[model samples]
Target chain A: MPQTKTQVLKIDKLSKDFGYRQVLKGVDMDLAAGELTLLLGKNGAGKSTLMKIISGLVLPSGGKISFKGQDTKKNPQNLRKSLGMISHQTMFYGDLTAEENLLFFSKLKKVSSPREKIEGALHRTGLRKFAQIPVKTFSSGMNKRLNIAKLMVMDPELLLLDEPYTGLDYDSIEFFNDYLAEFKKKGGTVLLITHQIDISFELCDKIAIMQNGVAASHMKTASYTYDDLIEEYQKR
Target chain B: MLNKILGIASIISIALVGYLVFFWAPIESSMGIVQKIMYIHVPSIWLTFLALFIAFLCSIGYLWKRAEIYDVVALCMVEIGVIFCGITLITGSIWAKPTWNTYWTWDARLTTTLILFLIFVGYLLLRKFMDYGEQQARFAAVVGIIGFLDVPLIHQSVTWWRTLHQPSTVFSTKKNVIDTPLLVMLLLSLLAFSFLLAFIASKRIELELKSRKFQKQIANLPQDHH
Candidate 1:
C-alpha cells in the first residue's frame, strides 16, 4: 500500500496585488513531502507569482505561507538556507567558473568541506569536464544544467522551478528527469511551473491548474488521462 | 502630467537664470565674464550631489522593504546624477582653462569628483549587464549604498587638501566671497537646476515603470509553442 507523506509546505488564502492589478486571489495549496506537483496555467494566471511568494522573493498582499511548520515570514533568513530556486535566469556569477560558483553557493549554504559535494554535483550534471570553464562561456543549455547542479549541491529540501525545461536539449532533459526521479524517491518535494504539459505530465504526481489567480482544478496524475488534462485546461 | 508641468517650469526658470547671469548680475572685477560660468557650474555640482544622496536613500529603502518601486527610483536618480555630474566636470574644465591656465588639474576636489562619477558609471553598467529582477536589485542596492561613501569625502576634499580649486563661497562660514548681486543670481540658478533635476528624474522613472510593465506583459503572454 502507498503511504501518505507529511506536509512540507502550506499556503493559506494567499493573495498578492501589484498596484491596481490582483495577481493571486486566495490561493491555497499543500505540498506533501516527496510529491512532485506540476502547476499548469494559461498566460497571466499568476503561476510565477505563486512561486515567487513561496520562495520569499515577493511578499503576498494577504495570507500565511508556512514552510516546515513555521511561518516563513517569521524567519526568512533561516528558511532560505533550506530552499533552492531555478528559473530561466541563472543565479550563478558569470565571472566565476562552474566549480567556483558551486563552491561559493555551497559555502553560503554552510555545507561542510564542499569540495567533494561540488565534484559530485558537477559529475551528476555531466559537467565535470567543464567545471573549470567560465559560466559566461557556457551555452544556454549548459547554464540550465549548471543551475540544476547548483541546486543539487545546496541539497535544498524543497525545489521551486519555473519553466525548468525551457532551453534544454533532449539528453539534458533526460538527465534532469532521472535526477528528479531520484530526488522524489529520497522524499524531496518539488513544485514546477511549465507550459510543456505533455512531457512534464509523465513525471508529475499531481496537477494543479490555475485560472484567473486561483486554483481552478486539481487532481492526482493517475486519476486523469493526458487528454483529460488537455480538456480541463482548455475549458479554463 | 506632473512631469510636463515641472518640465515647462524648469525651462522657463533656466532661461530666466541665464539672462540674469549674463546681463543683470554685476560682473566680477577680478575674473570678468568668465566668472559668470560659476552660476551654472556650482549649481550643477550641487544638483549632482543632491541626486546621488537621494539615490543612496532609495537604495537603502529598496533593501529594507524589497519594493521594486524603490529600485526604479534609485536607478533614475543615478542616471540623472551621472548626467549632471558630467555637466559639472565639463563646465569646471572650461572655467579652469581661463582661470588656472590649464584644462586639467590633479586638485583634490577634481580628483574626488571624477572618482565619484566613475563609481556611479560602474553602477549603471552593472544594471545594464546583470539579469533583471530581485537578484539584480539586491546587488545594485548594496553597491549603491557603499558607493555613497565617496560623497562625504568629495564634499570635504578642498578643505582637507591644498588645491587650485577655490573653497565653496556659498557654503563657507567665511563672509560671502561673491558680490551681493552675484550671490542672488547664484541662488536663482540653483533653484532652476533643482527643478530641472526633479523634472528629468520623474520622466525617466515613468519610462522605467512602463518598460517594466511591458516586459511583464510579454513574459506573461502564452508560450504554448515552446
Candidate 2:
C-alpha cells in the first residue's frame, strides 16, 4: 500500500492504558510539515502520553504511528533521530556549562562539527553570553533557553514541546513566541501541548483539543474562535 | 592529563612500597618469610572492600537521582573490586602455602573471600546480559548494590565465627603483631593500591562513556538495520 504525502506524522487507532484505566482511547491524528499544532485539554487529558508515544519514549498499547511515511514501530530509533523534544525536565547536567551541555547533546545527536553547531545554537537561542556558566546557576527562564539551545543542536525535523511555557515570565514567553515564529518560517513542524489559550491562538497554525485520550476537535486557526474551543473543551 | 599524572604517582609509590616490603621490612620469626605477604594481602583485601563500598554509594546515588554518571562510576567500581579481589586471593594463597602447609583452605576468611569473588563475577555477567543505555545502567546499579552487601559479610565472618583464619588486622592499632617497618610498608602499599584503584576506575568510566556514545551513533545509522 502507498502512503499520502501531506502527513509528516500519523497516529491511527492509538490507545494507551495503565492497568485498568485507559488514558487514550483510539486517538487518531495527522500532523503536516510547516504546521504548529497546539494540543490543548484539561489536566490528565493524556497530552503528555501522546507526545511521549510520538517521541518514542513510550509505546502505545495499540496503535500504528508513522513518521515521514515510515512505520515508527519498526524503525523508532531512526524516526527518533529526527525529533527534538523539550519537557519540564532540563535533561542536562546541572554542573556542566551551557556550552558543554550543548556540546554533549550535539555529540549524542552525532552532529558534524559539534563545537560550531553548539555555538550557533547558543547564538540562536540568545544564550551566547551565559554559555560559560553552569546550568545550576541559571534561572528557570535561562535554563529553558538553554534547553531550547540543546534541542536546536540536533537540527531535528520534528519538534515536540510539552508545556514549554510553564514557568517562563512574560518577557521570556514573548521571546519564545518570537523564536517559534522564526522557526515556523523556516519550514519546521511543531507539536506543542499547552493549556494557555492566548498563546495557542497567537502561535498555533492548528489547534487540537484532546479529551479523554481522543482528539475531540482539530481545526485551523481561522476556523475556531477562542470561545468555540473553550466550549468544546468544557462540553467533553 | 590529571589522570595520567595520578597514574604515574601511583606507580612510583607502588615501587617504593615494593622495595620496603622486600628489603626494608623485618620478617617474622614465628611464620618466617611467609608472614611478609601480609603487606600485599591486607592491602588488596582492604582495597577490594573499599571499591565495593564506593560502588554501593554510587549505586544509591544513581537510583536516587537517575544520573548516568553515577551509574558509570558504580560499574567502574565493580570491575576494580573484582581485580582487587583476584589480587587478594592470589596473595592469600601464596601466604597459605608456607603457613598452612597447603595451597588452599576452607577457612572462614578464605571461604568468604571466594564467595565475594563469585559475586563479583556474577555482577559482570549480569551487566553483559543487559542492553545499552538506561536499562543497562539500572540493572548494573541493582546488581552493584546487592553485590556490595557481600563485602561486609566477608569482613565480619572471621570474627563472628570460629575459623582457622586470622581476624582482620588492617584497621587494628596493636603494637605487638606488626612492627614499625612492616606497618609502614602496609600503609604505603594501601595508599598506592587505593590510588591505583581510583586511576583504573576513572579510565574504565571514560571508556564506558565513549562506548555509549558509539552505540548511540550506531543506533542512529540509516543503513544499519536493527
- Taking all chains together, each candidate's TM-score versus the true structure is 0.64, 0.51
Each prediction's whole-model lDDT (CA): 0.84, 0.79
- lDDT of candidate 2 vs native? 0.79
What does candidate 1's lDDT look like per residue over A1-236, in tens digits? 34677988888999886644567888888888888889998877899889899999887878998888899999888669879899868887899999999998888789986998889988988899999998999988889999999888888889899998988989888888888888888898899999888877888877888977887335464556889988988886
Candidate with best DockQ? 1
Which ranges in model 2 have alpha carbons more than 4 Å from their true place?
Answer: A1-5, B1-226
Runs in model 1 with CA error above 4 Å?
A1-7, A12-28, A33-64, A77-205, A209-217, A221-236, B154-176, B214-226
Report the alpha-carbon TM-score of model 2 versus the true structure.
Answer: 0.51
Tens digit per residue, CA lDDT, model 1, B1-226: 8998899999999999988887889988867789888888899888988999999999999989978899999999999989988998999899989877888776666767788899999999998898676667778889899999766766676446643355544334323566688888989999999889999989999999999898767755554533
Chain B alone, TM-score, model 1: 0.90
